[model samples]
Target: MTGERARVIVVGAGIAGVACARELAAAGVPVQIRERARVVGGRMASKRFDGRPADIGAAYFTVSDPDFARVVEGWRAAGLAREWTDTFVAYGADGRRAVPGPMRWAAPGGLRSLVTELAAGLPVTVDRLVLGVEPGPSVDGTPCEAVVLAMPGPQAALLLDPALADATRAVQAQQWTSTLSAVLRFPHRRWPDFAGAFVNDHPVLTVLCDDGDRRGDGEPVLVAHTTAEFAGRHLLQPTAAAAGVEEAVRDLIALPEPADHVHVHRWTYAKPAAGLPEAYHLDDDGVGLAGDAFGEPRVQTAWLSGRDLGRALARRLTA
Candidate 1:
């Protein structure tokens, strides 16, 4: 590691963190990213399942903002992203309903591909868990101009400096639930038309995706997501969760044979029901909080939050 003091240290390498880091670096600010995981993407990530990359976290994202749309366009041109579907089926207590014109998008390789592109050329340190933060200076004792906390609310709270936490008390963070995802590989293809399915009021299955159809990969991959209630109950048991999710998906898809392989993933902070109003929360003490928890629980919101924070920090630095 170089003995240089970074102008800003953006914690977490999820969409928010990477977006923030990209914006800050583009503005000519000396920035460093710290990620606890070996990979760069946090929740918008992927894992190898049965010799194929599968998205275990964020399946797809929607773009609404003009700026975000432009970014997606760039990604599309670079062959990193492609449209999944403009419509989706929502399953609820009543029944199944198809909503059109939603414009769901996905990365060609996996959601993590986009994150990797965002992290390109940025100084990212992986597997370094930040236990806590104190109000003082950088490790070298040089006063840090800014610090961006791009982690989930609970995570940020645990790592926040004592004084900063006190000042940001009013920034209430919503209680989140976990999710257990199972990527099941099948011998034969399934779902001829639809790429995904949202199953609600089901005991074990909440969402199921036909990964082959979704990514146009021509492989038999079924990604099953468990209900929040079920996930909370069996979050500790990976094998149990994976089995349950596989069974649920098999039933949902009415498969003739069992899946070849099953892989389970747990998301501690899946989504936030209620979030902070500010796009990016900031304190006069040079600490900022930005994440999907600060807005609607979505990839676009995470990106927007980080972009807003990066721009804010740039303005402050220039001033």
Candidate 2:
């Protein structure tokens, strides 16, 4: 790492962090990204089962903001992303009904690929966990022009020093929820033909996705996301929740054969309970915070939050 490089350190390699770094790099801000995970893509995670990848994080992403749309278009052009569906089945007291909305996008290689593509040519260090963010607006002991915490507020709060009153207060004010994603690989596709469904008002499951349909591969795999309440009960032993999750999925769709394989992933801070009006929080102390908590908890929102924060940081540093 050169002295001139990494003037700004953006923690968390999720879409938000990567998006922030992209903006800073575009503005020639010399930014560096540090991801504690082995790979990037925070919540937009994918795990492989029997050599086939299944989305275990964000089920799908939508495009709305003109800026985010353009970003999605680039991914589309590069064959990294594709339009998945515009409708989803909702299961509630009234029974199942098709809910039409914006077109949700998916990646053949999994959503994580999209982030990887976006972070191309940028300096990203994986498996490099940051211990602390201190008074000098520094990462661990390394000083930087600015520091962006592009993750869940709770996670950011852990790294913040109490002395950084403004940033600390901003993060502590945020509340988040947990979730568990279970991937069920079936021997064959016997479930409904829907691409995805909103398991509304369910105690166990909240969302279900046809992994085969979304990946455009037509495989007999399904991914189910558990409600925060259910996940909270199984956070300690996430794998122990797999059987219960699979049973609930089978009961919901009434499948004949059980899932041949099941894998579970836990998200302690899966989503924010509410969002602030601001796009991001950038304190005069040169400490910045960005994530979906700034708005609706969605992939686009997280990206926009980071993009806005990066621009703000760039302007401040440049000025």
Candidate 3:
């Protein structure tokens, strides 16, 4: 697909990029997705363990927008996703308690599969890292009619051409939080039956997910996300923090001790501290930004932001 570049080039093959490309393609505009990773699904990621795949990033996603609800409904009907839970157990120095929230959703093939499904048939160029864009809106020296950066604020800001210096500073002003995801596998199920638990006031752990129950087949695995502070402190040496996270996983879930094996993943930009108030941004040159950080850092927000940008860009191109 990279043999011939299209008029519109979307950098990043995550959900936002794919969704934007799909919309542009539907509008009779040719677009191609360029991703640095071998596969898509930025924070909505999954990786291999011993045999099966494990969700190492973004334990689950919640839907709120009516437009996003319709999208979720279709995914539900199509078997791309399922309701994970609405209530999660909250942890304190004292004990465990339940907290009710939005209906959380999960995918059988890990959250990454949903992005893969959404991007089906879309032209995606993987392992293609973008250096930066020229003011001509060129991507890595390849000129294109437009370029859509579907990534976090800081990462996107690095690609801004000098012509968009003001926008770059604005983008740079945005803040993001890092995360360390640890997935533990057990010889047998030993933890509580809760869907997920929120670890509060913990120095090491922040959130935990029962992967077995989540995947719908009931395999013995647990996924834990660490506090932003913890992740930042151990960003350079993520493994150094794994021992503490494992301890929390055991105690927070009322387990005896550590699991059989573990896998650790670091997210340098896991989530946004705050997103831009707008749904999307497009300078006069059609160079734009779309992602969860463009609005709210959620799965639905990413999709909506991308879709909205696509529609906006389509109108601009068709006009």
Candidate number of the best TM-score: 2
Q: Candidate 2 — which pairs collide?
A: none
lDDT values for all models: 0.80, 0.92, 0.86
Worst 10-residue lDDT window, candidate 3: 164-173
What's model 1's lDDT at 195?
72
Local error of candidate 3 at 175, Å?
A: 0.6
Q: Model 1 over residues 151-215: C-alpha lDDT tens digits?
A: 77777777765676542573345567678888888888754456787887898887778788777
Candidate 3 or 1, higher lDDT? 3
User: Residue 214 in candidate 3 has what lDDT?
Assistant: 86
Quality of model 1 by C-alpha lDDT: 0.80
User: In model 1, which runs have C-alpha deviations exceeding 4 angstroms?
Assistant: 1-3, 92-97, 137-143, 166-172
TM-score of 1: 0.93
Give the lDDT of residue 55 in candidate 1.
89
Two-way TM-score contest, 1 vs 2, winner: 2
TM-score each candidate.
Answer: 0.93, 0.98, 0.95
CA deviation > 4 Å runs, candidate 3? 1-5
lDDT of 3 at 34: 93
